[model samples]
Target chain A: MKHFSLRKLFLGCGALALFILAWKLVTDAKLVSPIFFPGPERTYAALVKGLSGGAMLSQTLETVQRMLLGWLLASFVGVFLGVLIGVSRRARAFIAPTLELLRPLPASAMIPIAIAFLGFSDNMVLVVIAFGALWPMLLATIHGFAAMEPRLYEVSALLGLSRAQVIWKLALPSAMPMILASLRLGLTISLILAVVGEMLASRQGLGQSILAASRSFRSPDLFAGIVILGAIGLVGSRLLSFAERRLLRWQAVSR
Target chain B: MVVTQLSTRPRHGEGNSTPASGEARIRIFDVTLSYGSLQIIGGISLDIAPGETICVIGPSGCGKTTLLRMLAGLARPTSGSVELDGSVLGGPNRSVAIVFQDYGKALLPWRTAAGNVSLALEARGCPGAERLAITREMLEKIGLGRHADKYPAEMSGGMQQRLQIARCLAQEPKVLLMDEPFGALDAMTRQALQDEVLGLVATTGATMVFVTHDLEEAIYLGDRIICLQPNPGRVGRIVDVRLARPRNQLLTRENPEFLRLRRELYDLIKDDHQ
Candidate 1:
């Protein structure tokens, strides 16, 4: 519940200003060729131009939409399977090793498989993104339920809770903090895979925009695309953290 | 011969239907618990009368909590049996409730005070419309009425324990098992809660099997105190509390009989540690 203090805010802003000054100096001195590395003003100008009712706006929205959808899909599949695997020792024993094997497979490795089935479509990109984002959530949820306090089992028994009641009323709430942390992790991966999938599949999104800009040596637009992506990441994480604060207030107000 | 003699009363199903008196009686028959050759409780037998409060005092590793868990049906005796109402207790019973020593882990952290209390009611399949009223009444009984909306993390240790007790009370349990519930609280809170618990027991007439490490808690709370020895835990001694009813915190402990019992029990437990 600690708010950002005025002094900390001032310090943060000051550091940003200093960084911008240093970037300007480097560009002016031509430390790197201006053709490859655009100056801040040029990047900013390109950003404004692209956002003000340009194709970049639609492209950015497409990327955000894809990221959110893929993340949601992975979340559903991950939690459903996670809970199934978590509550039963036999389920975990039988299926966990197979999941572990699939976990380490890279998203890039799955693109060809998705293309073979989906053929460079929106579905292909979503499949890639979901596959990449599923592990953190699944692993964290399984670990969360497994690491639960043993006392709760006794408490549940004494309360005469059924298996379903134990999972719903006892297990889910107990595993929430870990689940939330994993969800945040999953969200970041989802965004990364969304951008990668777009570039590889040639879908219309910020990823394709950046790829085209770099190939065409439109350095300003490329820089602008990178900046937009970073902004999206910041906003997505902020929204998630806000949700976390609201849901976890019980753990907070006590402190 | 070392058994604590069962206090006789009309048992359940004898047309005994009132909440003021006996509704259930617990009988432990040669209950022995062993974990893969590590003997915990060896051949322990006792009879708990309907509505009688029995406090078990023992040293560490004496299987006091183990014994209580058996009564709660959380753990099954390996070689022996626990019975209720003239039937062999199989699994957890709806009419049994337990208050653990570690109340922090016992309560749901995410739930409000009243919500936590409602968990027991929910398990009982109580009607949704009736849940709120019963939850409120249970809170009021344990003096947590004002803090109904607060979470367990927001409350003091004593209040959390009280909330746990309230949840158990909501079960309307015929048998309430406690495992040193106030062992972690401050002395003042512990004494206050003890009196409150006693008052609740007096009103509800529930059978209680309380496990504690403190001799005075056993003396102050029990109609009969069962002393247990460690290293293959078995009943060491059983003393009947002849002290007067409606026991006061100060007056009850000051009684010469209380001190004598405390001295005797202390030596009984102290020997096990050697």
Candidate 2:
């Protein structure tokens, strides 16, 4: 397993190296000007400078704060409501169509409405992130709860579990792996909405900084901001996957 | 096969009799169980004497398991009522423990062998110290002390079944209900566990209601074998094995009476639609 993982790591590094090589070639060939796509060294220097004495750190922190709050809110509400809807057939029938109508409206589309309603506050950004993140988490939760094996339910019944105990102990734990999967997916959505909300509805955050830098033709600064967002996203996803691994260790032991 | 009126006959009117000491543990009176439009077991009744080991055997879907579930209070009778002690059973009775067919699923995967056994005691409000003590004792009795810390998934099929049995016995119920507990194991494991089960029953002296599909097993373990036929299942015959106590597999299989009972049971259930 260590050998396999090392080989995979090397392969991923090689792929990144190849992409960078291509990017360098395009710049060297003047296929696009430095103004449009800055070189890696220039972007790195700008990232360092921004971190040292600029607003980049605060912007990144702001983005992270908004993202965390939105994602956490979405996850809690999504799971609670999803379990409720999933367990009761009548509630599912009544609520499903309304949720369906709301889900497909893009997170980006919500920006205009958020701006109209909240006028460029952090509230607008939060609304965008939460609305966008909730759908995947909710869907995953519903699927997880719905897919519980019937035998487990029978065991719960035979053991004389109350409805609440059944949900808390059996249903929740059994649905955990799937729920974690959705949370990871939802986190990515939160990142996208976080940036978009900042870009369209708010005047501060990584997204706003990137937009501001681009307008002033500070290509390296814009790239640095984008890189920070990418790093946050990559780290967030890894964290969730790590959590999934720990929580579902029963599966590992079985294997 | 639906012996409606036959089961209604009052065999023992003492309500509760141990029959051994002339006391009663449980009495079933004209109990009929149904689901939706289907009547599964109609007007069926039996008395489980204290410390008796009774096995129910029939073809598939003969409601053998349903009867066991009804006794366990996992299922309610549609018409007549089942009684435990002298009182009518409504829901799960306090003094009954059930071991199901699927040991893999029956034992909670999250809990270790000892933890699973401890649940029964925990439900009965046993203190933590007593629970731990009883769990260790029961696991040792089932030859599973070494695997007490292991989760159900870590054990083999036979070991898991034993763990479930230990769990049921840990509850120390007066009446024990087992629903084909070894049905899913390999033949060798099944036979071995059968011996172990008989040994446990002999030691504990709890009234046991075991459900099985195999006739030889029924004869090997049961003091009385109740046979049922399908369609809407009901008791076809109640053959008293009358085998001597302290039954061992070799001795029981070697007996002519056991062989005859197996043959008779096979012949009776041959046409069952299940």
| Local distance difference test scores for all models | 0.87, 0.81
The candidate scoring highest on TM-score is: 1
Pairs that collide in candidate 2 are B16-B24, B17-B23, B17-B24, B18-B22, B18-B23, B18-B24
State candidate 1's DockQ: 0.69
lDDT of 2 at A241: 89
Q: How many residue pairs collide in each prediction?
A: 0, 6
lDDT of 2 by residue, A1-255 (tens): 999989999999999999878877887787888888898778889999999999999999999998999999899988998999888778788988999899888888878887899888988888878888999879877877788777667656555557886787677877888888999999999988888888887558899999999999999999999889989999999898899888876666762
Off by over 4 Å in 1: A1-3, B1-24, B271-274
Give candidate 2's TM-score. Answer: 0.89
Native-referenced Cα lDDT, model 2: 0.81
**Tens-digit lDDT track of model 1 for B1-274:** 1222223321212111222245349877778877775677777777788888999988777778888888888888997789997799997887888999899998998999999999998887899989999999999999999999999989999999999999999989999989999999999999999999999999999988899998999999998888887566678778888899899999999999999989988887788678
Docking class of 2: acceptable
C-alpha DockQ of every model: 0.69, 0.34
